[model samples]
Target: MDGIIVVNKPKGMTSHDVVNVLRHKLKQKKIGHTGTLDPEASGVLLILAGKACKALQFLKDTDKTYQTSIEFGYITDSDDIFGNKIEVKEINYDFDFEKVLQSFIGPQKQKVPMASAKKINGKKLMEYQREGISNIDVYNEIEIYSISVLSKENYSFEVHCSSGTYIRSICRDFGYKTNNLCCMKELVRTKVGRFTLDMAQNLDEIEIDTVKLYPLSYLLDHIERIDYEPVLDIYNGKHVRIQTNANQVCIYDKEKPIAIYQRDHFDVFKSIRGLW
Candidate 1:
């Protein structure tokens, strides 16, 4: 029960809905999702169960990848097709694909989606926007690693972007450059760090009775590993010293993770979590 489940979230169900279902089905109360996906989006959603929830903060910073469809000539209030239509225009661009791709290359401040979980003054920004509040400061600088137009159908195109970089916002910018409105037609997260959609199971296809769950260690493969026994003195709450070439590593006893150890200035190890 203490591991991660990469759920291929079906469209129309909120991320919270998936968590709630798993909580009931798995009969575990300590379940949490690493990141939130829009109801219209479907793909890799990391669900942490039991004590695995404690490691969420560490995993939150991982990069994400998505294959998205952007439709031109129509804009919506939510930036995606799920929202109310705001405007429509004719697609009349002899688009310079290179310039379009270059526009997203450097650093740019992206306006956070009004329907996102960003907060303002201790209240969610989306709630404030719903109440007619429009002067909120919810913008953040998101770096776009790369953007390649997979296919162009008139003005609609398929693209892939890095984590925190909103595909809808990219469409909006594209529209701004071409004098036509644009909106996201669809989205599917392909990967979150090392986890990919290919390795995920759709909600409807999930056989709870025979589901194969990956151990939490699979997700922590990037972290260095430390053997047990030498840290027995610190397993029960006291910090132990150890020699290492790295600053931090995941300490394990046999095959069970004991805790994450951090190296001191003098090369001593200290537990960060685990050892309950």
Candidate 2:
């Protein structure tokens, strides 16, 4: 129970709801998710139960990939189809879809939608929406690593992006770039860092005994590992000198992660968190 559970979260349940359900089923009090998946979206959600919750802070910067469909013709108050219609336009089917998608392949600022969990002034945007306060403008830096069109006929595409990049905003921006209104129709997070949908267990079908909890080494496989003898320095959160090109590394002993280390100086590494 002290490891990662890759849950294929169903649509209509908030990420918190999944945690609550698993907590009840597993009877584990300390449980958390790596990232928040919109209630309307479904797919891979990494659930950390017990000691695995400690890895949450370090995992936030990991990149994610999503498969999403866009509907062109009109947009809603929310960036997705669940909101009130705010604008309508004819679909520009003749536009160069490939070129437009490629244009979004680099770093750019995205407008945060009103109907989102993103907070402004300590209040979630969604909370603001419920109170009839709609005049808020928020933007954040995002990068689209790659975008592969699944089917242009249906405006379906897969995007790999930075952790905080909103796929809904991408759909909205894509429509505006093509001179048509558009909204996200459907979304499924296919990947988060090294975790994938193929590794996910269906929430409804998963059982306590059937659940697969990945070890810390597997859960944090993306991080560079340095196998060394167990020492008091690592356990006491002390800095150790280790040669590595990576900005962060996991110190391992007998193939098990003992502590996560970050560079303090040139060769000196400071314990950021002890995985043990």
Candidate 3:
């Protein structure tokens, strides 16, 4: 109950809905999700349970990956298929698939989705937009790590992109090249940092008894491991000096992680998180 559960979130349910369901199913409070996935997207939702909730702040900058489809020949205010069609035009010219992919290269400023959870003037941007307000400006810098145009069928193409980048906005920008309509038809988050879709659990297929939970040590793989007798004394709210070449170490009580320590300026190991 104190570990992370990577759920393959289904489309149409808000991220909050997933937290609510898990809270009920797991019968534990203090639950939270790593990032917000739009209701239209599905896959790789990292849910923290119990004491694991404290680790959510550490995952905010984790990179994300998604496989998405873009439909050309129409544009919408919300950038996705759920929004009202704002423009439509026939696809008559030859589609330069390579050029379209290259347009998204490097860093770019993308307007946050209107229906996003981003706040503007202390209110959610979507809330203000609902009341016919448009003066608020909200944009974020996102890098397109890589893009591959899988296929082109008539006026649609499948694409993959890095996290913090919006597929719908990319589609809208792609449409601008030919003044055609474009929107995201489908989306699936395939990866989140080290976690992949292969390890995700589907809602209907979730089994509490068979649930696989990764220990905190799995996430701290980059940190060094320390095994010392006096380390336990320091880890137990007492300070002790032990000579070790490792600058950082994961103190383990047998197989379970008890605490993570980093060398201080005075060459003392300090606890990052104490396990209790």
Q: Which lDDT tens digits does candidate 2 get at residues 84-163? A: 99888877887877788888999988899999889888999989988998889899898899998898788899999997
Each candidate's number of clashing pairs is: 0, 0, 3
Query: What's model 3's lDDT at 116?
Result: 66
Q: Pick the candidate with the highest lDDT.
A: 2
Q: Which ten residues in a row have the lowest lDDT in candidate 1?
A: 153-162
Each model's lDDT comes to 0.74, 0.87, 0.73
Worst 10 residues of 3 by lDDT: 153-162
In terms of lDDT, the poorest run of 10 residues in model 2 is: 53-62
Clashes of 3: 3
How do all the candidates rank in terms of lDDT, highest first? 2, 1, 3
**Per-model TM values vs. the true structure:** 0.90, 0.89, 0.85
Model 2 misplaced stretches (Cα beyond 4 Å): 222-224, 227-230, 237-249, 262-270
lDDT against true structure, model 3: 0.73
